[model samples]
Target: MAGFRYEEVAGSIAGQVEAGVYGPGDRLPGVRKLARQFGVSVSTVVAAQHLLEDRGVIEARPRSGYYVRLRPQRPPQAPERTRPEGQPTQVTGQALVLRVVQAANEPDTVQLGAAVPHAEFLPTHGLQRAFSGVPRRYPGRATDYLFPPGPVELRQQIARRMADAGCRLSPEEIVVTNGAQEALVLSLRAVAEPGDVVAIESPTFYGLLQAIEGQGMRALEIPTDPDEGISPEALALALEQWPVAAAMLMPNFGNPLGHRASEGRKREVVALLEERGVPLIEDDVYGDLAFEAPRPWAAKAYEDRGGVLYCGSFSKTLSPGLRVGWAAPGRFRDRLEYLKYAASAATPAFPGFAAADFLARGGYDRYLRRVRGEYARAVARVRRAVARYFPEGTRQTDPEGGFVLWVELPAEVDSLALYQAALAEGISIAPGPMFSPTQRFRNFLRLNCAQPWNGNFERALRRIGELARERSG
Candidate 1:
């Protein structure tokens, strides 16, 4: 515990900087004096300052004290909250989605399009170690069909983790699946029938739109705030007007927009839907990736009557290749379990066992802490570059967590054209239209900030900015 005093010192100084105690280019007091002030050793102050430097909060000068790092110029205006007319529509734009995915796969391209974290940021060796032990630990169980409920070890791990999201579920309540996508699929099927309407956040993750389309359901786009999440007032109006069977929401660091709804907002939306006899399929795949400590709660956390079907996956935080995911459907537990059996049966056994192994051994919590900090720095780096390089009038989301940054380009610029131009330069960007069922958000785009920050990455972003400027011209 004495070793952690430096972290406390660093946090206190960072808080001071955040509170404007030190301005850009402002010098920090010499190491010894600060140590005296904080009641820590000079060595502790040095350690804390080293951490601040790594966090990009301060810079060390030759024979001079550290100064707060000068930040890039920010856009003067805030991004407008989306106000999609609450109308149910059939989803399209899967073609564009495919093209973006393909571009992301190109070996020579800068991967700033897909939301996948950079392979370097993932715990590749740790996961490999976890995977290698599956056979020895689980015996012949690793080779057999895991069945619907999956291996108890994995289900128990998931149930334990779900408690952080405010759900006290048994392993029996969890149904393992291929990924969050499959979990979403099963949740959607369990709650709604074909031809039903599913309310969703406007400018939502494209995958959600595709899932709604695949289910033969219509998506009613509700006005969503990039900071707060789907508007409850708009949702209430939509529910009153439409014959909605279910509502799919991502209250915890949602995709593309990267917004985390507040706990009060989550409770409000949950109660609103539960009272209307509507089911909420809560996609919380990115919940654990919050930049700050003490991860946020899920909308499912606020509901008790089985109205909220919670879906999550390790694909985003852990290993996507493992394809480990699960759903806690509460009252719809039986329905979702049967649907999982009918749709994909049991998922691959080794992945579940390996994932459970890693989680049980206490490797995941450590990785979560490291990965969250990595992503926070990466997101801030990309945000600074976008603000400094992009044309005036461009606004982007300041995400609370997750690796995605959604940019709202100038109205004169078409993000589709920008995407094509960036692709030609061996860079990939997610055009705005794909995030919508009706192909809206033509002037918007989302960028992946999980890539390691380097000259190549910065060059790619600058070139994308050039492309946007050309389009606007």
Candidate 2:
């Protein structure tokens, strides 16, 4: 019993709290008293108290005593902020790099985890050609940080381009980021706090989930339709039930889900949030890479206030290596821009300059046409492969645009095990669980339709399916 003194003290105190004997706000015995009761040293009692404090069981008062702080309740979560309104008051933390490493180290694995495009889709040679000319056009631009809002020429180009989507932006509103990830991270950091709740799509992007986890914030998962994106009614309920500080969503071809929110719903969403004074962070990275007929509208088009923070990246349309993404933070422009500067100083200027050149060549739309055509064909091939290889009960989302396929396997199949099993056969796939804050997609997998259904990819899918069968069986 002597050796178990600290354990006894901690357990008895914890039991008191659990039993409501020491109700919230009630004071616990001091070190001397607890030591006398438990027959432990004063230091031992103090250590036990500190342990309880760290566990959020009690709080220390300044010469007053340790009292229960009521384990601070979090109000229910609200909907994620949609476009054209609301600030993204969410705190995001460090990104997970383990899954990335596994996929990178084993090149033979069937690739499907990351949102990165196939190496062939990248315009590496074209980038090189443009880079070579950067010196002649702006000799020292690459050597310097573009600063807060970004390079003037690049920002102007972005403003001019967004005109197509009816997003009238002043060059002053745009802040360049290393990638869309940085834009989301910085926007969240600017608007949210450590314990604030942020609503997100149920089967959202894993990276966003990791960001939420890293920031020590709470994620409220909202029901999302495969076609129409997040449910408006469900979001409104969340808003009413929870004290959400902000929300983040991918309005256009959301990562992993590959669904676009309708323009009408977008307006309704913004208006609802504006009434509640909430902010929205819109991820539109795949807005331009739609494989469907015409491009969908931008969420920012409906903005009448400063709540919407719009994010886009050239990685999908141009080159990932470029890592060029920009944000138009309507009301929080200064704060978002300052965060961008503080976080990374600025995005590499040469890429922005080169991207401007690429866009200015008047071939940007033409290139998009070609890219969409290829993506459409690729999606078709992958769909057929899924039909042929995956089990009969498998349900897959047919995204209207973009190149992600969220496949729901039979309830018996566990995606985490499938990921491990597939990796053994030189294949990689995103396990379903990572997409939600609580890892709810245990029976799901996100397939990248960006890659062609070639021998390697098909073989990978076949192996993944086989693994799924093994787990299911």
Candidate 3:
């Protein structure tokens, strides 16, 4: 307890800095002074100072005392609430989405497009070692076909991890898929039939749109708030007007928008869907990456009626190359299992075994702690860069979790053209229109903030800002 006392002291100091009581660049109290002030020993105060320094909250000069570290100015105002017309529209933009995906994968381009974590932050060596041992661990696993529900050990580990997100899941309810994409596709197929209307958040992930289109379903864009996610009122109105089959949403740290629906909003949405007997598919890929302490609760945590289908994957937190994703399909378990069998036959066994071993050995949570801190710092740096580089009147999202920022540029700038220009300059960005089924955000774009800050990344931001100015003119 004494050893951990410094964390409390550091937190007190961090609170002071956040409250502006200790302004940036202001020297903190001397160790002796702080010891006296907090009724702790001088050694404890020194530990507290070291902790603060490690968190980037304070710095130590060679001869001087610790001082609050200067950070980038507060980010520009978040974009306004989205106003998507409550109309069921056929999903398009597959061609543009394909082009952007191709460009994002180019080796020479600066990757600011795809919502993927950089490999440097991942546990590459540990995962490789785990993979190497998989064959020996399960002699025939490499050559065998894992059934629809996947490896028992992986599902068991996933069920244990789900407890952190406030969901009490069982290994039996979980079904493994190629990735979250496959999980999402299976959930969609299990719930809604072809030609049925499914409601989704406006400015949602492009991959969701692709999934909906692939299922031959129409998308009903709901008005979504930048901070609170989809509007419950808009969703209720849409439900009243249309014969909605099901709803898909990212209730915890949604992609593109990076908004988390409030628990109350989640309850309201869930209640409405339950009342209407509609299935709710929740994309929780970013749930474990919360920037702050105490990870936020998932939408499925409030589901008492088993109407929520919870989908998650290690792609965002762990290695995407593993392609290990799973879903707790609640009431739709049988249908989803059937869909998984029909779609891909079965998920590969090697990655599931590797991921399961990684989780069982407790490496996953430790890696999450490291990457969560990195992502928080990286998001702050990216926001500051956007504030400095982008044209005037540009707005961006301040995400609570996850590694993506949604930027709304000046109306005069066409984000598609900006995407082209950025690509030509060996940079990749996800244009705004790609996120919507109707291609609505012509002047918007999304940036990936997972990569560590570097000179090349800075140069890319500067170039994008210059291009934004040119396009505005």
The global C-alpha lDDT for each of the candidates, from Candidate 1 onward, is: 0.87, 0.75, 0.88
Lowest summed lDDT across 10 adjacent residues in model 3 is found at 67-76
The digit string of per-residue lDDT tens for model 2 on 1-473 reads 54467667777888776554664456887789888887779988887887788877788989899976443111122122323122233423223336643584465656787766786766666777777888788887778878878888888989988887669888888988898888888888878888888988767876676667777788888878776788778789889888987878888888777777889988888887878888898888888877654688787888788898888888887887788998888888889888887888867878888888877776577777667766655655566577668775887766666777888888899887787777777777787766766556678888877775567787877777777777776
Poorest 10 consecutive residues of model 2 by lDDT? Answer: 72-81
Candidate 1's error at 287, in angstroms?
0.2
Clashes of each: 0, 13, 0
TM-score of each: 0.87, 0.78, 0.87
1-473, model 1: which lDDT tens digit per residue?
A: 65799999999998886555664456899999998999989999999999999888888989888977653123366567898877899998777887887765687989988887778888889899988888898888889998898889999999899888888889998889999999998899998989999999988998888889998999999999988999999999998899999998899889888898999999999999989999999999999988766889888888869888898999888877779999889899998898889887788998899899999998999999788867776777788788878998889887878889999989999998888888888899999999988999999999999897789999999999888888877
Q: Candidate 2, TM-score vs. the true structure? A: 0.78
Model 1: lDDT equals 0.87
Scored by lDDT, the top model is 3
